[model samples]
Target: MKRSPMKPGKPLVRTPFKRTSPMPSTGMLSVQSHQRTAPKRKAGLKSKGPVSTPIRRAARGQDCTLRLTVCNFDPDTTVLCHSNYLADGKGMGLKAPDTAAAFGCSACHDVLDGRRPRPADLSLAGLEAAFRAAVSHTHEILRSMGLLDAAPAAIQPTLEHP
Candidate 1:
C-alpha cells in the first residue's frame, strides 16, 4: 500500500462541544460561571454597618498608643490577639467571651497561631499563661475606663466569711 504525505502547515480540525444554549459573552461555560455574577440581594433587607464585637469595643476604649501586652516587645505597633484555643476550634465549647482577647505584636501573634516556631526558652504553656494574663489586664483596663460593665457582686468573693 502507498502512503500519502501529510500536510506540513495545516492543523487538525477538532469537533466543538455542542451545548443546548450559547455560552456567555465572557467566554466561560455558563453552568461553571454562574457564581462569577454578583449575588442578588433579598428584598426588604437593608444593609447594616459592621457590628462591634466585645474585643473591638474593649480595645477601642484603651489608649491607642499602648504596646503589645504579651511580649511588650513592640511599643509602637500592636494588634488584637485572640486566644489560640479560639483559633484552634477548642474554645468554642468554653465560656470565654470575646473580651478574652488580648493585644500582641505580629511576631507573638504568629507564634500563638503556630505559623512560626516558638522561642527556644518559651513553651506553649508559658505563652498561653502570658496571653491569659494580658487578657486579664486588658479587662481591667477596659473596666477602669468604664467600657466593660462591672462584674456582678456575686462573682466577686467577699473577704468576710459568715
Candidate 2:
C-alpha cells in the first residue's frame, strides 16, 4: 500500500463527511445531528433592508435628513406610517405621504406617542416662519453643494396633498 507524505507532527485519521452548523461546539459533532430543531421563524419587516429611502442622491453636500435620520419614524415597524416616501424623496414636496419630515406633524404622533402635535403643517399660519426657515435651509443646502446654480424652483407648498 502506498502512503502520502505527512508533515512533522500531523495526524492521518480522516473524519466522515457531514455538514456542520455555524453554532458553537457542543462537545461532540454527533450531538449536532441529533439536536432538536426549533420551528423556523420567518424573517420579519422590522429586520429589514431599507425603508424611506431617497430617489435622487441628495444634491452634492446636502444631508438627506429624510433618508439618513430614520431612527424616529421606522417605516418598517409602523403599519400606520403610510410609506410613500421610500420610492424617492417625494415627501419633501410636502405633497406626498412619504417625504414629510419638516412638513408632517403627523409623524410626531408616530414617534412621540401623540404627546406632541405635528410640528410643521403648512396649513397652520404659525408655521409660516418654520416653513420659510425650511426654504432657507433648502436653499443653503443646495448652494453649498453647488446644486443651486440652476436651482430647482423654490417649493411652494399648497393645501393640496398629493
Candidate 3:
C-alpha cells in the first residue's frame, strides 16, 4: 500500500505560461495607442461659457447638505453635486448649472443621482423635495462664502400709458 502526500484536487507541479502579443513584430502602433497620442478636442467654449469650475472647487471641505439616510457625511467626499432634474438644466449627457448644485457626500450623491437605491422611508417625491432643500441650503452656503451672486428678483412688466 502507498500513501500520497499531495492534497486532494491539488496539482503537485506547476508551470508558468507565457502570453504572446497579437501585434506584429514590425512595431506598428495600435489603434488605441494612436488614439491616445492624438490631441483631444476640449468640450464647451470656456470664453463666456457656463463652465464654473470655481464653484465646484468651493465645495471642497463643505458639509453634505443632501444628508440622506445613506449620507457618509465625510467632508473629503463632498462636492457640488448638480441637480439631475431637467428643470435645473440637467439632460442627456449634460449636467445642471452649478448654481443648482448641493454639497453632497459620495453616498448621498449616489442616492440623489439614482446610482444607489433610495432609502426605504423616502418616496420619489420626498427624495426630490429633500434634494431641492439641500440645493437651497447649499446656495446659502455658497452665497455666504461669496462664491455665488444673490438670488435673482422677479421682473414685473409695466403697462405703458397711451
- Tell me each candidate's TM-score: 0.51, 0.25, 0.65
Question: For residues 1-162, what per-residue lDDT tens digits would candidate 2 score against the true structure?
Answer: 698677888877767965464667667665445666898878762454434433223422333223211235433332212223334244553333322223222333243333445354333443334433444555555456564455568898889778
Error of 1 at 139 (Å): 0.7
- Say which prediction, candidate 2 or candidate 3, comes out ahead on TM-score: 3
Top-scoring candidate (TM-score) = 3
TM-score, cand. 2: 0.25
Residue 65, candidate 1: how far off, in angstroms? 13
In candidate 2, what residue range of length 10 has the lowest lDDT sum? Answer: 62-71
Clashing pairs in 3: none
What is the model-wide C-alpha lDDT for candidate 3?
0.86
Model 2, residue 31: C-alpha shift (Å):
67
Question: Candidate 3: which stretches are off by over 4 Å?
Answer: 1-52, 154-162
Q: Which of the two, 1 or 2, has more TM-score? A: 1
Q: Model 1 compared with the native: what TM-score?
A: 0.51
Instruction: Sort all candidates by lDDT, best to worst.
Output: 3, 1, 2
What lDDT score belongs to each candidate, Candidate 1 first?
0.61, 0.40, 0.86
Best candidate, lDDT: 3
lDDT of 1 by residue, 28-76 (tens): 5556544346789898575465456655654542332213233446534
Question: Which residue runs does candidate 1 get wrong by more than 4 Å?
Answer: 1-72, 86-97, 155-162
